[model samples]
Target: MVFWITLDPLSDLSRPPGDLSSGDLLNQVLYVALYCLTMAKLIDLGWRGARPLLHPAYLLLLAWFAVSAVLGVNPGTSVRRLVLCAMVMSIVGVLPILPRTQRDLELWLGTAAMIVVVLCYLAVLLVPALSVHQADAPREAGLAGDWRGIYDHKSTAGPMMIVFLFIGAFLAGQGRHLFGGVLFVLSLVFLLFTGTKQPTALMPVILLVSRLALRTRSRLLFLALCLGALALYNLMTVGSAVIPSVSDIVAKLISDPTFTNRTGIWNFAIDRFLERPLTGYGFMGFWSTDAVLQSDPLGQLAWTAEATDSHNSYLDLALTTGFPGLCLALWVVVLMPLLDFMRARLDPTKRGLALLFFRIWLFCIFVAALETVFFLRDSAVWVSFLIAIFGLRYLACYPVRP
Candidate 1:
């Protein structure tokens, strides 16, 4: 988590190095070594926590990814991205088994989260230019004064602090009340200053919904709540583009109905998606590509051709891997995580840990509505969500006591 977070700070992002992948030799080597160590540990544990890796949904998702790699518009890029993603998945797969008990799990994760929090604060205090966005910065100058806090963007920092809030809550509920409370307060204070309104607004509500989800114990109800949030958010943002009435309503409701010019991007992406709906351009292949940017030129109002992603994860998946890939992703990453959480919660002793992961999963999944996060190439947000995914799976598959 720390590696991903600190790997690409906002300062480095302002002046990105050429050939991002080739220059990332250190990351490649570290991932390989960690992958080997985890595999060895899995073997020592008699391959514990390996069942979910072989699930039919996960297998089909892999198969579809292979299909995308072979048939994608850019086969070379797809293959490289596929390999990197597999390495991350392998590490995520074995992580849950390392902790023998719930307390051990909390300690390891809490310590890492606290480290992240401390480093973020230090960046803010000692290197304000890097930690806080500048008004005169070449890019997104309008976002001046926002606290990114060691992250690439304020949006990224805000959601991550929200995840840490849940982690703190988990620790407190588990008997480390003083430490956990401190973590919670620190994260909350940091989040308030992130200058990203969406996550800040979702903070208290997420806490309430998560507690209610645990109390209700209805998987269907949980899905209803998540899908409802997605629809409301989409309706206000991109849905306005699909319906004239929605556009008019949104225009009346907000100062900028275009949602910072996202509607044009969404429309352009939709048109492209319609062209090759079955199989997308390729995994992470649609945007920022020479062929794509040069061909099917977007209109003036459209998002910059240099845009890294479509700003919507589900759309990015469909744009890259096709509609089939998106469906598989929904089943594999979305639905399956929900199922794991539901089953895991039934184990009374593991409920607290399970709830913590579930809460994180919900937030990431919801936030992805407006962000390209699901498989965005080793992003800290993606890593955090995967940890929640596998963590819940482990709790459901194995009964552990604190």
Candidate 2:
């Protein structure tokens, strides 16, 4: 949690010649702790008890990632990424084993989230130089050049606050009314100051839909809604290219037709992906590579040299691991767990857990369209999604009746 909040803070802290970033170092330590705990649990449970704890689809997904990394363009970097991937999955795998009850899990997570939120507030109040974006710094649309509130960029802060908003909602539902309400309001204020347009606009609608989904308690309904939304998004994306009116209207609405110049980045990424359709350039390969920089796909665009990611998670994954990796990811990271969540009986006692996971999954799906989040190393969003996926699986298999 501390690591999540302090994402690579620019401190005068000294380190060895070849040390990892503070965030990565902390993540590795957490991974080691989780590994030890998981191994201990496995030993105590024995093979029969542990067998059910393993999710076959997740294991298969891990295997595919390993294979892709081994065969990837940058073998050294891919191998390192593969290690991080395994560590992340291991952390998620042990979640069910670590928590004694749903309440216990909720309490632990809620408390931790609250602590992070409080720390963010303190950083913003005490150290504005480090926490807020500078006037001359790049600003996103709708921010009016205000504070980012404890994150390096407005982009990062916006998404983090969004996560905290839902976490606050969950805490409130769990009867931590005052604490949760305060956190939610503070998160909203911070989000507003960051000036993030999409997430800020979408929050209310997402919350409303989540409430409806929980009330319906029908997995098919949720799935149908998701499919419909995805279809609509695709249509808009396609229409932007084929229909001038659609493009004009979107441009008028957002005040930037190219989605703040993301289209150029996406186009470059697409071309790069086509070059290596079967196996991509490798994990974190394309953006920083000399070949990509030399090609200069963006031409005279302002952000050409500054862009780090494709901005779309799907595109990023395709660029990193190609079609095979993308397909495996869709199946294991998304489809399988979605199917499981839908099929699992949502008893009264499990409804809260079900709804929490459902909300997180839905949020992840929506956010992926605009952000490069899937399988990102040391990312809060990715970690949150893994928790949701594994937590739902645990609840489904165990079927705790309160």
Most accurate candidate by TM-score: 1
How far does residue 118 in candidate 1 sit from its true spot (Å)? 0.3
Over 1-402, each residue of candidate 2 has an lDDT whose tens digit, in order, gives 633555465331122122221125665676677667777776776545445446676676666666666776656666676777677666566665566676777777777777777766787788766566554334333343455655556776787788788878877887889977887888888888777887787788778876776666666787777667855664454335445787787777666777666666777777778887777777655654554655575566555455667888877888878887787777766676666566553577776677777677777767777778788765777777777777777766776634
How many times do residue backbones clash in model 1? 2
* lDDT tens digits, residue span 268-352, model 1: 7877888888878877766666646555556453444557777788878888889999999999778888888888888789888
Per-prediction TM-score? 0.93, 0.85
Per-candidate clashes, comma-separated: 2, 1
Candidate 1 residue 131 C-alpha distance from true site, Å: 1.6
* Model 2, residue pairs in steric clash: 143-195
